[model samples]
Target: MNVPAYAGPSSVTTRSGDALSLPAPRQDSEFSIERALHERRSVREFGKTALTQDEVSQLLWAAQGITSRDGLRTAPSAGALYPLELYLVVGMVRDLDPGVYRYAPAGHKLMKIIAGDQRHKLASAAHGQDCVADAAAVLVFTAVERRTTRKYGSRGVRYVHIETGHASQNVFLQATALDLGTVVVGAFEDDAVGKVLQLPEGEVPLYLMPLGRP
Candidate 1:
């Protein structure tokens, strides 16, 4: 098994002024995969406390942080053509402004796309699921199909879905390790979600993961 390699701040060279630099992800953890898997559950109830930036960083890192110098991420992609994009709907994170932010795994940083908390709107878009509104932060997963389909043709669509499962599961396990509650939510209107994130054309929303202290 290829584990996620940690690339500290010293290794991150490309970053824009607007992007918030993330803390280095710790590879060593007392929690083991077997334990995380045994304990992993779909968490809907969450605490009102705000999440720390380090927790946010670890979660995002598990989802899609680059694990190697060649840009190989925590999750594998078909043909190494990563089509997935991660967006965060920030609500109650410490020291972080509430807004819509995009995660760039290459630099392990967040770029603000929209200002203010939009979690309520997102919950509405998610068919009024309270979990979406209650979590301190929600990670929205999107994909540009053409990145994979352009090469694999019709079958590439399946590859995108498989990649999504891989990425989402990583978050689940990482959440368990951090003692955070998270659940993968897929029941939502496509158009509504795209609008909530103001996603670009061709980027399809695949999953909504609301995360916070249980």
Candidate 2:
């Protein structure tokens, strides 16, 4: 849609920067959705090439962003109660700055939490996964329990994970199509990630996906 400039740190408007207008991929992509699914693998090793702002925008859009006029999302939700909140831990990217941002799916913007590189901390939190540091960006998915729990009670927890799976699959497919690499990390210090993202008490971290050049 729109591509907006990110005013660094003190001027950080939202989590992740606003989507910027950039060149779209060629008519032919590296992989189709079905092909991507067939070829998908957790690529822990990454090249030094950094992701561009447009790539980040496309990735977030594919994940859980709103796609419909009524704010309907790309990922399915239980009872249509969307409980997932996405965050971006940017380590290295070109044509933009780096920081920990919250992905505002509706506005397609980012709210910065902390500035500078913190992949080491994320790697440590993710059970010493070097990929967290090697990858250019790490996407953190959090769920606001009340959104679903109010309807499905404790069973809502399962739905949240299912919804996260949908969102993660979107990222994986998008990565494959864009010729990038991605890895999902389940082990992490939830409280620590929440601290890093400045999440509220009811918001719980669920999944972590790192993206980079393969």
Name the best candidate (by lDDT).
Answer: 1
Model 1: lDDT of residue 101: 92
Structural RMSD, model 2: 5.2
Candidate with maximal TM-score: 1
lDDT (10s digit) by residue, model 2, range 1-214: 2323333323322332344233322234546678888878878888767777778888888887777798898889998899999888887766546778777765667766777777888888788898888888899889997899899999998998899999999889888887788988898898887776778889999988989888
Per-candidate clashes come to 0, 9
lDDT of 1 by residue, 23-81 (tens): 88998888989999999999998877777788999999999999999999999999999
Which residues of candidate 2, in runs, are more than 4 Å off? 1-31
Each candidate: what lDDT? Answer: 0.90, 0.78
- Score candidate 1 by lDDT: 0.90
Which 10 residues in a row give candidate 1 its minimum summed lDDT? 1-10
Clashing pairs in 2: 3-19, 3-20, 14-110, 14-111, 15-102, 15-110, 15-111, 16-110, 16-111
